[model samples]
Target: MIGVSVIGAGFWARQMHLPALAQLPGVRITSVVATSPESAQRAAAPYDEAQALTDIAEAAADPDTHVLDIVAPPDVHLPAVEIAAAHGKHAICIKPLARDLDEADRMLEAVDEAGTRLFYAENVPFIPALQEARQLVDAGDIGTVFRVKACEGIGEPHSPWFFDPDRSGGGAILDMAVHSLEFCRFFAKAPITAVYAEAGTFVHHDRTTAEDTAVLTLRFANGVIGQCEDSWSLQGAMDSRFEVFGTEGRILVDNLHRQPLQVVNARAGWSYPMPIAGLVADGHLAMLGHFLDCLRSGAPSLSDGHVGRDVLAVVDAAYRSVASGRREEIKETTR
Candidate 1:
């Protein structure tokens, strides 16, 4: 069996990762790690063999832990991944890989030196509708794609850390926009050259220091104009949409609005907190399946560390553009 250490006893771990783990046969949850034993134990309660621990190093160093499944916030990702790599363990780090470029670089370096895989847990590509959309765009059904737009909006995140810049690294841009930004890259399939962003804490000033609303413009090498809007002031409703404009035809996707069949398995701990939770759940499972396949076959992952770093670079560039009040070049980010 492939032993797994899920290193966060939070919402994502309980609601998202655990149910997915239940469906997979060969993997076992060896540990549930958290900042406190109570949280860890609460999260690990369903799995009989899972050990509750506060020390991440102990979990990573375990002989049975082949992978450290990190579901923590952006702040803990690097340290958790670093510890995993130090013990020669593969890791699955969730979206928005780092706060900045240097941290992303160190993550890549550690994994490279350890000769282990760092699977970036970016699930947007695994969305069923988006996958079909990508296929059509690639097959020339949309002719030469030129303009891409994507947006994801939510009222507020369940956790307070998302509002805490010290924990989350950035606001709506880094949190929700990363999804849309990665989707933009997914459609463009080219290097982003420059990015301009307008972001501020428009509504949630009392809640967070980070921006609650933002828009990002991306200039791709292939001349694709990619724009992303992410927001947290949508009241209680959630909205997600993607549009691709092309010479011959156009494709538009609204993933959250409707679905033919939806499920809410309370016993399974899979509840529909967000309107798109069903789709997101499927994406999470599909993404995990792909990573497990990579682990077993010793193959490359579609959303690997390199891809994560690339996305982070764009995010970093967006923040820079906000600071400079001009389009920032991704290549100039090193300076």
Candidate 2:
């Protein structure tokens, strides 16, 4: 069994990663690290066998821990990943890999130098509806995909830290838009060439540096066009939707939290309540299992450090496009 240690016991970690890890096979939660010892203890209570410690170094140094699952805040991702790499442990870190592409590159370099594998835990493409859409595209049901549109809207107001450009990495674009961008990249199976974006702080104007909403247009290398919208302040509740148009047909995925796929075509018109299997089994659990499989078999990671860096480059280009009021070219890197 692969021994696992979770870094950070925050809301996402508790609600998603911890519960999922509890059900995964061939994996054991050996320890947990948090900012506070009490919080770590509380987080580890469900897994009685796991130790709770405030010191990250202790968890990183443990000989029993074969993998480190980092679900910490964006800023702390690099440090934790570096530590895990230094100890020759495989790591799975939540996206966006780092605040910027430079940091992501450094993290990737460290992991490569240490001869350890790294996985970027992006759950969007792994979601049921999105996965179904990808399958359809691969099956030629959508024919030649030419255009795509996606949006992620969250109603809740973000904390002050989210408003700080440095801490949050330029507001909605990196915070929310990356999900849709990555989805488009995965489905289209093409590298993004350039981006043109517009951003504004329409809702939360009081914040010194933060955009409450953003819209981006992407040009893929294979002649595909894509658009993405992201917002922290929306009229209604959270909404995640995506649509892909191709020569033969089209696919649409809406209400990702509840429904999976909704499809419409020239022949069949529209189909409601399309059935699709959720990717990754139990979400975070599936990610953990995949990481363990990679560790044991020396298999290549699905979302490796190279892929993580590419996503960050897209994010960085989007922000640059927003600032310059012109299209920015995305730099390609080895994956």
Candidate 3:
């Protein structure tokens, strides 16, 4: 059995990761670390065998733990990885990998030096609909890929930290666009050359200093262009969609308001929360299972440190472009 310790017990950790881990075979939750002892206890309450601690070091030092799953904020990512490295444990970190490219590199160096595997828990590409889209592109149904469009619009985030630029690194552009951007690179199979972006806090100006909505256009080295739109102002349910246009045909995955099944309640009007690709998606289960499988078989992750770092580079360039009011060249980083 692969015993794992979770570093953070926040929303994603409490709702998604733990539930997914519970359903997986031959894996157990050994420890849970939270900001406070009470919160940790609350997080670990579902698992009677699990221990709750306030410090990551306590979980990292656990002899029964084989892997560390980090779902903390952007800033603490590298430090969590360092603690795992010190104890010779494999790590799975949720994106955005780090606050910036430099910290990402340092985290990569730490994992490599410790001879431990690192997985970036990005679920966009693993989505069944997106995976089908990828297969179509691979089978040449799309002919020569040229342009892609991905968008995500949602109401305010559940956590307050998402609004703080310092804690989240940025606002919608950083938290929401990262998924679409990574999947764009995955399909393009090319490095991003430059990024041009425009962002503003038009909707929630008083709530956050960071931009609540933004759009980014990416130019890939292979001549592929990608457009991404992210927002925190949309009302009601979440809306996310992707479209890939190629020389021959086009592929579209719409999960926003157009789901297979829609339920409308007398009190709640129109609700489409059943088949979302984002929250509570089946992709989360697949992602966690893949991580455990890789841990057991000693295989490399599809979303490794290098891929995570490259995604951050695009984010870095996007923010720079937002400041300079001009397209910024991305300094590509490779594994």
Candidate 4:
């Protein structure tokens, strides 16, 4: 069994990671680390077998801990990842990866230099509906994907940390649009070459630097065009949806947090109600299980640090395009 230690026992940590780890086999929660003793205590309350600590170094140095799960805030991801790599432990880090591409590259470099495995905890692809959509596209149910569109927004916004650009990276682009970007990448099966974006603070006016809404258009390497609409402030309820158009047909998935896959074809019109089995109670568990499996089998991680770095590159380019009022090319990194 692989022993895991979790850092930053916050809402996501408690509600997602801890519970998911509890349900998985061949994994043990060896330690729970938080910014403070009280935070760690509160975060660890649900896991009776885990110990709460405030120092990541202490947790990483623990002999029993084979993996380090960093579910901390975006700002702390780099430091936590570095500490984990320093201690020679495999890591699973929640996304946007880092505040910027430079930090993301550094984190990946550290892990590579340590000869440690790194898994990026990106759940959007692992979601059953999205998975099915990918399968359909790959099967040529939609022949020659040419265009893609996706959106993710919440009617209600929470957490002051999310509103701060310095803390959360950017606004909707980094926070919500990343999911849509991943979806487009998954369905298109091509690298994004360029992006043009626009952003504004439609709501949450109190924040000065961060935006509340944004729209991005992407040019993929294979000549596919894609667009993503993301917002932290909208009319009603959380909404996430995607549609991919190809030469033969189209595939769409809507209300990703709650709904299933839907497909439409030129010959058949529409196929509704595609049955999907939920992957896991908590996505963190789904991702964690995969990480443990990789560690056990010496398999390569699906969402490796390089993938995280690539996503961060796209996000960075989007933000630059927003600022410069021109399309920006995504720069590929060797790391």
Top-TM-score candidate index: 3
List the candidate 1 regions with Cα displacement exceeding 4 Å.
259-282, 332-335
Better of 1 and 2 by lDDT: 1
lDDT of 1 by residue, 1-335 (tens): 88899989998889888778767878889999999999999999999799999999999989999999999989999999899999999999988887767888899999989999999988888888889999998899989999999989877787899999988998988888889988888998888999999998877899888999999999999999999999987665567898999999999988765644434443432223464565253488888888988999998889998888888888888999999999999854331
Each model's lDDT comes to 0.86, 0.80, 0.86, 0.82
lDDT, model 4, position 113? 96
- lDDT for model 3 comes to 0.86
Q: Which pairs of residues collide in model 2?
A: none
The candidate, 2 or 3, that scores higher on TM-score is: 3
- Tens digits of per-residue lDDT for model 4, 53-87: 99999999999998899988799889988999999
Q: Candidate 3, residues 38-127: lDDT per residue as tens digits?
A: 888988899858899888888989899999999889888999999999899988999899888888999999998999988998888878
Candidate 4: stretches off by over 4 Å: 256-283
Query: Residue 77 of model 2: what lDDT?
Result: 85
lDDT at residue 289 of model 2 (Cα atoms): 64
